[model samples]
Target: MRVLAFLDGTLADPDAAHIRVDDLGLMRGDGVFETILVTDGRPRELGPHLDRLARSAKMLDLPEPDRAAWERAVRAVLDNWSGGAELALKLVLTRGIDGDPEQRPTGFALGMEIGAAVLRGRAEGVAAITLDRGIDPGLAERAPWLLLGAKSLSYGINMAAIREAVRRGADDVVFTASDGSVLEGPTSTVILLRGRTILTPPEHIGILPGTTQAGVFRGAEKAGFATKVEPLRVDDLLTGDGLFLASSVRKLTRVRSLDGTALPAATEAHAELSAAYEAEYA
Candidate 1:
């Protein structure tokens, strides 16, 4: 079952929650969203998620989201959703109808059951492929209007890349820059294991700052692994000891292979990644 709540205090019937057809968010993808992991009735890293939401809004020039209101709506959905199983809590904020200045922005919170594939892939690992993003991230810095670092709803390209990954016989993708520098996965952050250090690309290169990776890096430190945020390239993954992906809903999932070639299996490190992901608060 799904539990949904509107910022306007609407709850119970999801069908009743609706946005206008002319809403800029639906028409032009003028919106931002966050996918959160909810274990039982508790949300993981809610503060970080909200802060990112605000940052995305500021990037889009949308009004700052009312965080307290969003938190309450999240609670209401969790209360409505009854179960001990993990759930994906999606918070969506959109620009309201065009020319309707009086109308507040459209926003809602949705709590839904996690899919079997995402949950199973966590423990079993997944296959991935690398695709060039075809744009220099340095261009992203100069072209600030591209909104590169924000988690906006303009995800048509990202979804298309995933379809390409499936066609290539892989479960996910790791996007590289135009120069073949490692960036991140479509919906996850890329991590590489080298000796006792965990390395990832810095977020300043036009990629979204991963909230899950932040906590996981901390947990990895506690688990006796040093974590570093730096620049990486395709060669690094090809020669690394192991590779993994981390996301809020997916937590941490090891990459069993990339580009159809099997990677070196690091079962022990995979377990540590899982344990570290679990150590993140709910």
Candidate 2:
């Protein structure tokens, strides 16, 4: 793994304790981030990831990210990476150290080979538990301060939820709104398949727009699968023809079970959709 920090347009070692203790992102979790997949030395869906990062920064009132600087840092780390496996490239932007007169933002890029656990989950499928997110689906529209759509650095709750799920003997979690509408996974997007139609929860429901899901839908359309956005419920997964959690690094992973109930097998669809997604980067 290698990390390169972009400080005022210059790149430096991330692990050398370069960030100040007063950095808002480190102190108050005031920041935004994106995780991109690098395959064969090329970042997949770089445009969408950067677009989302900009949107998140705007939502958080942080300075506009320097896309070119981030790109250079990504290239620097990837060029020096010697691993033959796929890599995960993370881009981070944080509000500058608190009380600083200049009020700048800290930005950096980190590159690491994809973990074996993530790869195994994608191959073996995953069992998930439904966790209540404790918010209504429409809350984001009414309360913008919640920052639901922004991929902010404040992920402590999300991480805790996943940890709790694992403690309960599940591999992951599918978060549902208070009204029982499926929102998304803690770190991935939820997608359902009924016949040849591919369905996902509407983005307006305070869920992060999934870059991998967008790519999957595009490829699905070409592969004769109708794509749709709809409100989904737990019953949808228990009875649907197939279910998956999609993301940039994890790619397309099937949901083998939900709440300990075995889901219908859709391995062929999963394989097709997974290949379709990979084709976008190819």
Q: Which sections of candidate 2 miss by over 4 Å?
A: 7-11
Query: Per-residue lDDT tens digits of candidate 2, residues 154-235?
Result: 9998999999998999999999999999999989999999999999999899999999999999999988899999999999
Q: What is the lDDT of residue 116 in candidate 2?
A: 87
User: lDDT tens digits, residues 83-189, model 1?
Assistant: 55789999999988888858569899998888888988887889999998877869668988999989999999899999999898889999999988999998999
Q: In candidate 1, residue 153 scores what lDDT?
A: 95
Clashing pairs in 2: none
Prediction 1 global C-alpha lDDT: 0.88
Clashing pairs in 1: none
CA lDDT of each prediction against the hidden true structure = 0.88, 0.89
